[model samples]
Target: MFNQRSSPDKLMRIGNILITPLLVIMAVVGCTPQPRSVDVTTNPTPTKLVPDMRATTTVIPPTETLTPLPPITLDARVAEIEALMTTYEQMDLFSGAVLVAEGGEIIYEKAIGYANREWSILNTLDTRFRVASLSKQFTKILVLQLVEEGKLSLNGTIDLYLPDYTGPGADQITIDHLLKHRSGIVGEPAVQNLERIERDYYTQEKMLELISGFELLFEPGTQWTYSNFGYYLLGVNIERVSGRTYADLMQERICVPAGLTDTFPEVTSDIIERRASGYWFDAERGFIHDSPLDMSFVFGYGHLISTVRDLYLFDIALREGKLLNSSNTNAIYEAEFRPIGDETCEAYVVEDGPASINGFRASSHSYIREDRFVVIVENVRSGGYYLPGVFEVGRNIAAILYGCPYDQPPPHVGD
Candidate 1:
């Protein structure tokens, strides 16, 4: 201030001195250490917050899978069903064999009541029963087999085999008509025409002769009419083409293939031990011990002797296509509706429905419903009050287990 202004060189030297010291102090302050975090809190306790420093690794346990259980065996359920049959045996209501099976495995089997009440011999599983119209299925199979082999066709006429046998409506009928029960030949001349016939000695040829004498009930293929004559003609056709007795053909072709050792086309002295005595109900005859009524008269119509076990085996084997080709097997499974055609026939909607188990003139009906409901009822002894009630009891048991409709059985008459 006293000197006022200085020289340019002197002023520059004084500014450099001041600027060098200030730069040194600024560099020292930037390089010096500082606090990691600064506290900015209004509370009394001021603190720095940080995440947990200790490291951790998460591990999840593996999940365990649950295993499924096995199916119930047929053998396990057999005893429970056998108990139901036992009740009927105790009341003396039913006799003969009953077997229920699935997939070739016997689930329940029993032989109740007497095979021969006169001899006091009880029935066994091997005891045979006359399986009436069921024989038609066998005859049907034999014909179909011939069709498969090209030996015959379903459309072939009867005249192709049976020459010199001329009738008014014979040419109008075809082999297919016979298999389908549509031939409409008049059968049963009277109320029980088949019952009075001596069934012991009639042969296939004789059956044809008998049927040929009858009139045509309706035009062939016009409609179905249950015709034993039609099946008789089929038996004739088989014998004529194969040149083998009907019995031999059935034994070799069907019985052997099905492994039904106890089943046979006829009963003779050799099979006396296996045959069940036939019974009859008449005002004058009373209870009689008749030998197994010969199946000869009905041959291809109503003549088959089989045990329940053998029948079940045959049924499953045929249905499963183990015995025949799949197409042929399916053809047989298609319903054989009655020619008269009633709504009642369609009312029963279950697999393997009512099966006709026959004696001589009398036939028993048994059925195993879907959902595993089984009912086997029969008139082993006719005119006995207990047989009908036994069937009712069987239905009740089936309803309790499977919830199906109960069948009301007729009164059982005593011998």
Candidate 2:
């Protein structure tokens, strides 16, 4: 308090010294660096965490491999065929019975359309139909059987069997020639006259007499022409050599051995059960009753009636060698005999055998190497004409079995 009032000059000097030191302290404090501002938008570096040293290694189990399925079997093929035929039936393109087999086992079977259209009788598996030219196959088999029994010789001339007959080329034509269609006998006349004569019943002798009158188309074995007369002559030879009727021999030697209960020589006059009435396809009328025939006129050429089941049995018998030995079967399949005329002969091989007549069609295919076969019989003539051909149906079925492409039936042309 007493020294509060100091001299002006002295007070000024003290104040200056104090103020200078304070200013220097303030500068030093301001110069010191503060904490830098952080940018919140920038990503910060991740913190590395030390893994636990005591942890065990992680393991992954492997995936399992799956097994593939087996291939399509005969049974499965049967189902496929069933579906296919059902489709055809819905289209009204198929009628009658079809039977397919593999290794002598039935794979597929079906009956479609009507056995008697007028009565609206649906066809059954047991329904019988005329096998038409399929009878030739049976006749051929019978001839081969006769050869085996020493009752006939393939090389023997027709004259050897029918010595009393003296027709043109009959002496020169051999059994083999007739069987192979190499006999140059004219067939057109007989075929053309069938409609006229089909109504009349003829005995074997009378039938031969009628055939003998036809002129030879060419020298024996010089050309090929289908001759029902040739097969008819074979039937006569079978009768003369075996001392049995053709029907009797067929029953004992073929039908009985093959276990074919429904196969027999057709007797037009005899009333038969489950017989299919034949129908012809008319472009305008759809389906009409087939022209009447005596059945006897077709004779050994094509006069047998059978069911698909029976035909299947016959096919099985053939493949199992129950009908003929391997040698004879081989000859039947492999024998090469050419025709003599300019007309090419379409020979029936073992792999494919087809037969057709007025209102009946039958097809048989032997896939011998594969042990598979198929048989199709249609009682209606125009059943397959406008759509799939009768034999084409069999081929299409085969293509399905083999997993191959097949042509579909054409669209129906008529209403």
Candidate 3:
């Protein structure tokens, strides 16, 4: 079924919507021989230099106030969401797009805030946003496709795919372990714990070496530890087994067949169309430019860029069993899922959900017992205040849109 319309403010409630959340992701990817971390630290530049953009919103004097968005409707719930987003926008907590659909019909769609703050360019419905950790779900589907094709096995050890791998967990971590996060392979403490690694540059070779040397946090399969490096290794193995690149796999295996055009692996050098500039907020300074990242560190797990529409296609693909058999497609929920909000709210549990990176945040989930879909991609990060993540935002939207249970969000006080 085709979806409906989008607006910057005051969107129409065209019809009932699906209550599931669709994911968002960002960045490019790199693949190694097998089970190796890879990414070409995003070109020669240390940070992305956003080229000047021309759009509906023209240049505004840096010191001048921005023109106010005209409100579209008197719909109360829609107004609540619009108000919530506006508050977030003023607070520099969110800047991107949202889409909600029910029964395969578009119920609500809107873009909020700036895509390129320097240019005063408004984020449109089609603006591309990095899905970040949301890429893992996409990766999981690809892996299952291979498993379905008998090209890979869920229980296959890393060494089975990457004979070159000799790390301590190489033989111990199975594809299943990686998928379920039972690999015990946490990221390097120095890298993972860094508060600002987004500003640091890392080479593909260096990232690989670091992961190869990491000691497992515990025995594989006996523990469930989310590992980006484990997903990175899966990317390597995805390439090694299929004898294809990640982009190729995405284009052929998923995008082409599923009718997803604006979705693909992020490449550092390519100038993507309708791409949004990443941003971070500072309480004293307001919106700050999102720093450039040049690390191959996020290869498979985090380096994907997409739009709400294309991601909706992806969600539909999985739900309709277009990507895999019914048995395997259900694997999306087979992993460990932590509940969405605290005791005061009722929302779906999420598994390996995305955490914000530099300029992007996202939330995608399904099955709220209402056949609804709630997808939001926020292209800015919060630096000054504790911002409710897109996941929390999605939960609130779901409550309003599909009559799901939720309460007003508690303040996230930041240091």
Candidate 4:
């Protein structure tokens, strides 16, 4: 059974097959895919892809006559994913970037739509967008690295490292609780509901002061509420314990070693080249300009800005166990994630995880078992709620890649 409430374990639960790691990353996190020849960093660009549209009656455009697929090489299964993208972009459902890799090679990648609509700039492979809670994975790695270095203990309380933190559950909250979001640090009702926060400029000191005043929602480790404040404290703890700035530690520990050039903490004051403008999509009013958030507001929870290529390199490095010792690398997979949905196929099952913030949604879904996966990061999202987001796109993409069943969206109206 796919038990969402079960204790976190090392079990690799696919639709039906539960298996072991590596050799078995062949399944990634779902079903096994027939082996294909590919590996990390191998990108082959084909000038033209004959679209292999499937799912609910696909229509070939009137202008282009369908060439008979070469019998020698049937249309690539990945093309179905491209067809899906065309459908999404036509519907104004997705805009940003996507990269897909399998058997260790990048099979497909593309940048779609406008990066900055005002200037009419197009999104490119190198475009940088705020990654939101995806930053937590780096925080998780840093915390685990500290454990490996004997500088911190997962079971240890936050008070051990940062003595000045006077939050409600400083003594009761374990570092483990914080990492898992089991920390009970509840923000003010207004912050929790995200009212007028986008317009406020928060400095690090002021943000910490705000966190200091937070009260716990429940006893530590007894429940989960996805506390950004808990993660902010972890960042503060990392700085306090390592005596290095978060940016310095990240660049030294993860980016430099992983050969990641474009991944870094966000700085609102600096002009970040190729940074994409985020927008809110309103069906009735069209695209509304997304408000700028203080870098401090994002803080430890979602502060990093990166591109698809850099995100892929980081995934390759981490899964190859280059980022941490074997134990911690495996821990990344085993660590509990707030379950995505009741049925497994409905979610991307990101090895690092999936997240959204304002105008952006990011997912790093890997078939570690099949050595296959999809990475999606986009700008422009509905202001009302989450959904019609990348999670749906990635799930369908994975299904196409693995030959699993998935519904391809029908063509958009009047296109």
What do the candidate models score in CA lDDT, each in turn? Answer: 0.51, 0.65, 0.64, 0.67
Candidate 3's C-alpha runs over 4 A off are 1-80, 86-92, 192-206, 334-352, 402-415
RMSD (CA, Å), each prediction = 37.8, 38.4, 15.2, 11.9
lDDT (tens digit, per residue) of candidate 4 on 1-415 = 1234423242223333222322211111111112221112223442221121111111212222323322321145656666777665555556788888765566778777778888878788888987887898888888889989999999999888877777788888999998888998874343754647645778667777777776678999998887777888888888888999999999999998777899999877889898998888664566777666767677777889998878877877777676788767766754222222222222224344457676777877765544565788988877543235566576677656544444544333332
What order do candidates take by TM-score, descending? 4, 2, 3, 1
* Span of 10 residues, lowest total lDDT, candidate 1: 337-346
Ranked by TM-score, the better of candidates 2 and 4 is 4
Question: Candidate 3: TM-score?
Answer: 0.74
Per-residue CA lDDT of candidate 2, range 75-153, in tens? 5666666667766676666777886665445556778887777877788888898887778888899999989888888
What is residue 73's positional error in candidate 1, in angstroms? 11
Q: What is the TM-score of each predicted model, taking all chains together?
A: 0.66, 0.76, 0.74, 0.78
Per-residue lDDT over 1-415 for candidate 3, one digit per residue giving the tens place of the 0 to 100 score: 0112222122211122223332223222221111211111111111211111111111211232323223433255566666566555554445678776554555566787777878777888878988888888878888999999999988888888876565688878899998887998876354664546544555545556667776789999997766888888888788889998888998888887668888887777688898888888665666677677643557888888888878777776666677778777654644221233221223332233445556888877553233456688887786645556777677667656534334443333341
- What's the number of clashes in each of the models? 6, 5, 25, 16
Clashes of 3: 25
lDDT of 4: 0.67
Using lDDT, give the best candidate's number.
Answer: 4
> After superposing candidate 2, which stretches have Cα over 4 Å from the reference?
1-76, 188-193, 334-353, 383-385, 412-415
Between which residue pairs do clashes occur in model 2? 222-340, 223-339, 223-340, 223-341, 224-340
